[model samples]
Target: MTPIQALYYFVEARPTRTGPPNVGIGAILLIVAAAVFIAWVAWLWIAARPSSGGEETALNLQPYLSDDELETTKLNRVLRAAM
Candidate 1:
C-alpha cells in the first residue's frame, strides 16, 4: 500500500471507546477551598454569637446602679430639673 493509504488505514484502525469525564485539578481545589471558606464563616458566626448568662458576669456595677435605683434616680433628676 502507498504511504498515504497506510496512514489513513492506521488512523481509522484505532478503536473508539467512551471514557469517564475528566475533572481538572483547579476544579477540585476550588471545591475544597469553597468548603473550607464556608466552614470558616460558619465558625466565625458561631463564635460571634452572644453568650447567655455570660453578660451578667462580665458587667461591672461599680459605676451603675440596679434597675429600681436607676428609675428612682431618673425620677428625682426629672423633679429637680422641673423645679
Candidate 2:
C-alpha cells in the first residue's frame, strides 16, 4: 500500500471511545485562542515600531523652539484657525 493510503487507513482504524468528547473541543478552542493571541501581539509589536521613512523626523520641531516661543506659536496657530 502507498504511504498515503496506509496513513489514511491507520487513522481510520483507531478504536472509538465511549466518553464525553470535550477534549477535542477544548483542544480546538485552545488552538484558536493561541492563534488570536499571537496575531494580537504581532499587531501590537508592528504598531509600536517607528516608521522607517523621514516623515516623523521632519515633523519634530522641539529643538528649534523655546517654551515661550512654542506657546506663542500654538496661540497664533489657534487664532489663525479660528478666523
Q: For this target, which candidate reaches the highest lDDT against the unseen true structure?
A: 2
Task: Give the 10-residue window scoring lowest on summed lDDT in candidate 1.
Answer: 53-62
Per-model TM-score, in order, reads: 0.40, 0.40
lDDT, each prediction: 0.87, 0.89
Q: List where candidate 1 sits over 4 angstroms from the true fold.
A: 1-21, 54-83
Itemize residue pairs with steric clashes in candidate 2.
Answer: none
Runs in model 2 deviating more than 4 A are: 1-23, 56-83
Candidate 2, 1-83: lDDT as tens digits: 99999999999999987997866888999999999999999999999999878655455654777889878988799989999
Q: Candidate 1 local accuracy as lDDT?
A: 0.87
**Model 1 per-residue lDDT at 77:** 99
lDDT string for model 1 (1-83, tens) is 99999999999999876885588788899999999999999999999998785445446555667789878988799999999
Error of 1 at 80 (Å): 52
